[model samples]
Target: MLSTLQPLLGLGVILGLAWLASERRRAVSLRLVLAGLALQIGLALLLLKLPFAQAVFLSMTDLVLAVQRATQAGTELVFGFLGGGAAPFETRYPQNSFVLAFQALPLILVMSALSALLFYWRVLPLLVHGFAWLLRRTMGTGGALGLGAAANVFVGMTEAPLLIRPYLAGLSRSALFALMTCGMATVAGTVMVLYAGILSDTVPNAMGHILTASLISAPAALMIAGVLVPEHPDAADRAIVAIPSTSRSSMDAITRGTLDAIPLWLNILAMLIVMVALVSLVNQMLGLLPTVAGEPLTAQRLLGWVMAPVAWLIGIPWSEAQVAGSLMGIKTILNELIAYLELAGTASAELSERSRLIMTYALCGFANLGSLGIMIGGLGAMAPERRDEIVALGLKSILAGTMATLSTGAVVALIL
Candidate 1:
C-alpha cells in the first residue's frame, strides 16, 4: 500500500536531498551513513519498542513530571494565583487557568539547577562518557568530537563545545562542522522539561520522546555532516579528552546554573511576546489580500503550502500535512518553543495521533535562525581564530541540523 511505502520513500528522499547538497558528493561514505542509520533505528526500537526499555523511559518521564510539580511549588509561592495557586473565585473553565510563563516555564530554572548540581557531583560526566565511548567506538569520532556530541544531548549548544575547549583550536574542518551541526540538532536538557510540559496535554510521555529525539539526532547530525563535509582519512584526532569540572562546590554549581538560566529565561519570554504579536500583525495585514478557495490567506497558510510536501514526505497523511507543515515552518523561522506551544494549543486538535508523534520528533531541535545566531556568537567567542570559518559554516549547520531531525522523523515514521 502507498501508506506502507511512504516512510521508505521519505527516507530515500531525505538522504538524496542531502547528497545533492553535499559539498563533496564523491567523498560521501555510504558505510558511515548506514552505520548512523542503523544506530538511530536500533536506539528507537530498543527504547520505544522493547518493554523493559519502555518501562525505564516511562519511569524517567515520571521523574520529569515530578520535577515539574516541584517547580510549581516555587512558582506558587512567588506568583500566587498566576503561578497555579488556588483561584480566589471558581471559573467555569478549569483548563483555561493554566499560565504558561508562570506555571510551566519555571521548570527550566529548576532543571538547570539540578543538571548543574548533578554535573558537579560527577554524575552527568559518567553518563556523558558512556555515550561518548559508544560514539567513538561505533563512529570512529575523535575524543573531542565524541564528547562534545554526547554533551549536546544534555547541555546548550555553546555549553557543549566548552566540554572540548582544549581541542576546539586544533579541530579539523570536518570535525568542527560536525560539532556545530550536532549542537544545532539537539535541544538542551534545561528546556526539554519545559517542552515536555508544553506538550503533556497532547503527547503521552513527552519527556521520554524529547530525550530520545536528542539522543538519536546526535548520530544523525554527525552522519549528515559527514555527507556535507566528508572527513579526510588523516583528519581524525583521537586524543583522549577528559570532562572538565568547572564548579567549585555543590552550592556554587546551583548558584551559577540558576544565574546562567536567567538570560535564557528572559530571552524566551521576550521572543514569545514579540513573535506572537508580530505574527498576529502579519495575519491581520494578510487579511486584506483576496481569499484563496474561500479562505483568507495568512502566514500559516503560506508556510503550510511551502512545507506541506516536506510534511507528507515525512509520512504525515495529506489530510494533516498542511497543519504539520505550518508548525515546522514556525519552528525553523522562529524557535522550537513557539512550535511546541502551537502544537500544545488548539492547532494540535487538527492533527491525527500519528502525525502529532512524527511532528514531535521533527520539531525537537535547535535548528532555527535564532539558534543559528546564538551558535555563531558563542562558538565565535570560543574559537576567535576560526570566527570566519564558523560564520561561513553557520547556515550550513542549520541545513544539516534540520535534515538530521527530518531523518529522525522518517525513521520514526518507518517504525511506527
Candidate 2:
C-alpha cells in the first residue's frame, strides 16, 4: 500500500533535503546518513517488537500516565468548581467557545507548579533514573549524561542540563552534541498541556503519546547526535556524577518554575502571532502562481507537493500524502503548535486510525527553527563560552531533532 511506502518516501525526501541544507551533495556523507537511518530503523524494530522491550515500554507508558493523572489532581483541585475536566464553560454561557480544561493554559500552569513540586520531592528524578539507566546500558551513553538526556523528556530542556550540570563542563564533544540535540528533540513538560489542548478534538490521548514520543526519542537523539560528531574522546573511563538538587522548599520550587515557564507561555503566544501572519503572507504570494487546472494552489500546497513523499514514508495514505507531508514540513520549519492547529482543521472522524496515530507522533517534537533559537538562548545563558558552538550546531540539531521524532513515529507506525 502507498501508506507503507510513505515512510520510505519520507526518509528519502528528508535526507535529500538535509544534504541540500548542507549546501553540497556529498555522496559519502549521504551514505553515512543512510547508514545511520538503517541503524535507527533497526533499533526501532528491536525495541518495539521484543518481548522484554515491550514490557519496559508498557511500564514506562504507565508511569507517564500516572504522572499525568497525579498532575491533573492539582488542576482539578483549583478549577474543578469552575469545571476543570467538566463540561465546557460554554455550557454555562452558551455563547462561549472556550473549554477550560480542554483549552488547557491553566493545566500548563498547574502542571508547571506541580512538576516543580515533583522535582523538589525528587519523584520525577527517580523515574528519570530508571529510564536513564536503560539509555546508559542500551545506547552506550555515559550514565550522568544519559540521566540528563532522559530527564529532559519529563522536564524543561534547560532544566535537564542541571541534572548533569557537574559533568557538562567536562563532557566530550559528542556528549555535548547529544546533550544539545536532546534539548531540541524533546518537548518540555510545560507545553505538553498546551499541545494536548490543541489536539484535544482530533486525538484525546495527545499528552500521553507526546510524553511517550519524548521518551523514545531521547535515546534515538543520543544515537544520531553521536553519529554526526563522535565524542572527541569518549568519556568511557569517567564516572557518572549526579548533580545536586537545588530547591529550598516546595514553594520556592513552584515560584522558580513559574518564572521559568513565563517565557515558554509568552513564546507560544508570540509564535502563534508571527507564524500565522507569515503563513498567510506565503499563501498570498503563492496564490499569484499560474493555475494547473482552474484553481490556484497556495505555497503551503506547494510545500505539500515538495514534501508529500515524506508524509507517505511516515505511513500517511497516498490520498493524504500531499497534505500530510506539508503538515510535517510545516511543523519542522514553523513549530509543532502551528502544525497542531493546522492538524485540528485536517483531522476528522473520516481520517484512518493508522493515519491518526502517525499524525500524533509526527507532531510531537521541539524540532522547529524557533526551538533551535531557544536552545541557543538557554544553553548560551548557562555557558556563554558555548554560544558559538550552539549557534553553529543549530540547524543540524533541527535535522537531528526531526529524525529523532520521526524515529519515534516510525516505531509507532510499525505497531499500528
Candidate 3:
C-alpha cells in the first residue's frame, strides 16, 4: 500500500509545484502536469510491471547484447585473448576504463548499413510506417510528422530527417518543430545499445527504462512543442503530411546505410574524445580555484549547485538533490552518455533508492546541446527553405525538449 501510495503522493507534489510555477497559465500548466501523471502510471503498469512487457523489454536487452557482442567480434577476437575470458561484468570496474561506447562507435556504420539494407529490403520502411501509423492516430499528427518522430526514436536526429525527405517542404511549422524536438528528446537505437552497456550492471533494467523514457516522451514532445509555437497555419489546415520514398533494395541499402553511419560514428567518437579532453582540462583548471575545506569547486560541483534547485523542483530528496542536479546539468550541456558514465562511476550502491531511480529516468533521453545542433542541421537540410525557422526555433525547441524529458522525470519521480 505504501509503495503504491508513495507514487501518487509524488505525483501530487509535482503537479502542485508545476502549477505554482506557472500560476498565471494555471489551466495549461495543470493539464500538462496531469498528462505527465497519466504517462507515469501508464508506463509503470504497462511497461514496468507487466509480465509481457518485461519479456519484450528483456528482448531488447538481449538484442542489444547480441549486436554489441557480434559487432565487437573483431575487437574481441584480437583482444579477448588478453582479457575477454574475464568476468562479463568486469567492464563495470572503473579501473577497466575502456568503454565500448567509443569502442563500438563504428557499429553506427554497421547499423546504418543494416538500416539501409532494411530500407532496401523494405523491412525498415514497414517498421517505420507502422510506428508512424501509431503516432498519427495517437497524436493526431499527419503521416509525415509521425514518421519523422518515430524515425528519431530509432535513428539519429540527422538520419531521421531522411525518412521525411520528400515531405519536408510540405510540413507546417508545428509539425517541423515536432520532428526536431523528437530528435532532441530521444536516443537512437544504436546509442541505446551504448547506454545499455554503460549502465546495465549498475541498473539491472537500464535498457527497458531508457526505451520507455524515449517512447513516452514522444507525445510529451509533441504536446510541449505545439504549445511553445503552435503548428503552422498551413499544417493545421492540412489533412495529412505526405510520406516520402519507396523502399530501397537490399544491396543498395547495405551500401547506403554503411555510408550514412560514417558521420554518426565519427560524431560519437569525436564527442567522447572532445568531452573527455575537456573534462580533464576543466579538472586541471579547477585545481587552482579556491578550495572549500580541502576540495576546490569544480564544474560538476558548480553544476551540482546550480541544478540542485531544479532537482528539488523535480521532487528528489534534499540530500540527493545536488547529485541529481549535477546529472541533469551534465546531460543537458554535454550529453546523457557522459552523465550515465559518471553516474555509474559513482558508488551508486551508496545512493538512496529514490535518487538512483530519478537519475535513471532523467538521463534517459537525448535532450542535450549536441542534439539541438543535430535537430537544426538535420531539419534544416531536409527543407532548406525552413532553415531560418529551424534556427530561430532552436532555443525554444531546446526548452520544450528539456521540459519533455523533465515531464518524464516528473513521472518517474512519482513512481519512485
Candidate 4:
C-alpha cells in the first residue's frame, strides 16, 4: 500500500513546486496541466505494453543494436586495442581499455550522418510535423512553438530553433520559454543510440526507453513551461512554420551532417575529460573532511544527502534513495552522460528493478549547466534581439526541465 501511495506523493510534490514557481500562479490552466500529465502516462503505457507498438519499438531497438555493432567493427579496425580490439600488451582494468572517445563517441558521427539522410529524404520532417500538430491541437500551443518543441526531440536546441527561425522573433515569451524548456528536457535522437550503447548491458530495451523519454518529455515540458510563463491574452498568433528538408543532394546531406557533428563530438570528449578530473580533484579535497557514518565525506555522498528527498519523492526505495539522489545530482551538476555512466557502472544486484527504472527515467535529459549556455548561444544566434531574454530565463528553463523529467519518473512509478 505504501509503495502504491508513494508515486502519488511524488506527483503532488512536482505539481506543488510548479505551482509555487508559476509566473501567474492563479491563471495557470489546471485542465491543460492534467491533460499533459495524462498524455505522458498514456504514451508510456501504449509504447511499453501494447502489442503492435511494443513490437515496433523493440524492432527499433534491434536496429540500434545493429548500428552499435557496426560502429564497434569500424572502431576495432581503425584503432585496435584502444577501441576494444585485442591489446598487444596486457593492461590493468581491461574493461576501461575500451575508451569512450574511441568506442562510444564514434556512434555520434554515424547517427548524425544517418539522420541527415533521413531528413533529406523528407522522412524526419514528416514525423516532426505530425508530432507538432498533435501538440498544437491537444495543448493549444502555437504552431511555431509546437514545431520547435517537437523538433527538439530529434535535433539539438540550437538546431531545432533554426527550423523555425522566421517565427522566433515574433514568439510570445510563454512560447519562447516552452521552446527553451523543451530543449533542456529532451536529448537529440542523434545521440540516443550512444546513450543506449552505454546502458546495453543493464537496461532491457535501451533504445525503447530512450525514445519513450523523448516523447514523454514533450508534454511534460509543455506543462511546466505553461505554468512558468503563462501566455498573454494579447500574444501574437504564430504563422504556419514550415518543416523544410533542406539539402543540395543526398551526398551533401551526409557530408554536412558529419561535419556538423564534429563540434558536438569534441564538446563531449573535452567535457568528459575535464569534468571527470575536476570531480576527482574535488573528491580528494572532500576526503579530508571529517568522516560520516565511518566513511570519508565525498562529493557523491554530499550530493546524496542534499538530493535524497527528491529521490524519495520520485518513488525510489528509501534504502537506495541516497544512491539514486547522487545520480540525479550528478546529472544536474555535471551532465547526463556522467550520471548514466555511473549508473551503468553500478552493480545491478545492488539496485532493485523498480529503482533502476525510476533512475533511468529521471536521468534522461540535457538539463545540466552546460546545456543552459548552449541554449542561450543557439537561440540567441537565431534571434539576437532576444539574447537578453534567453540569458535571463536560462535558470528557469533548467528547473522546468528537471521537473519535467522527474514528472515522467513519478508517472512511471504510479502506473507500473
lDDT string for model 1 (1-416, tens) is 66668877887887898889888899887877888899889988887777587556556556655766788899999999899899888788985897877975676577667767877887665655565567656776666788788778876786677555546787888889999999889987767878998999899989888888888898899999988888886676633445565889999989877776666556556645655577678879999999999999877668668888888998899889888888988888778988999998967899988889889999989987667766776677567799899989988998899888988888888888
Off by more than 4 A, model 2: 1-134, 236-303, 347-351
* TM-score per candidate: 0.74, 0.64, 0.70, 0.75
Clashing pairs counted in every model: 0, 7, 7, 0
User: Candidate 3 — what's its lDDT?
Assistant: 0.63
Residue 131 lDDT (model 3): 58
Per-residue lDDT tens digits for candidate 2, residues 7-57, read 666655555554454423332233334445554566556554564654565
Model 1: number of clashes? 0
Q: Cα lDDT for residue 261, model 3?
A: 56
Which prediction has more favorable lDDT, 3 or 4? 4
lDDT of 3 at 370: 59
Candidate 2 vs candidate 4, TM-score winner: 4
lDDT of 1 at 264: 51
Per lDDT, the best of the predicted structures is 1
Q: What is the C-alpha RMSD of each candidate to the true structure, in Å?
A: 5.1, 6.4, 5.8, 4.8
Give me the runs in candidate 4 sitting further than 4 Å from their true place.
54-133, 234-236, 239-301
Q: Write the per-residue lDDT of candidate 4 for residues 200-293, one digit (tens) a residue.
A: 8878877778878887888899888898888775562554445455678999988977786677567555645655577678878989888888
**Candidate 2: deviation at residue 406, Å?**
1.6
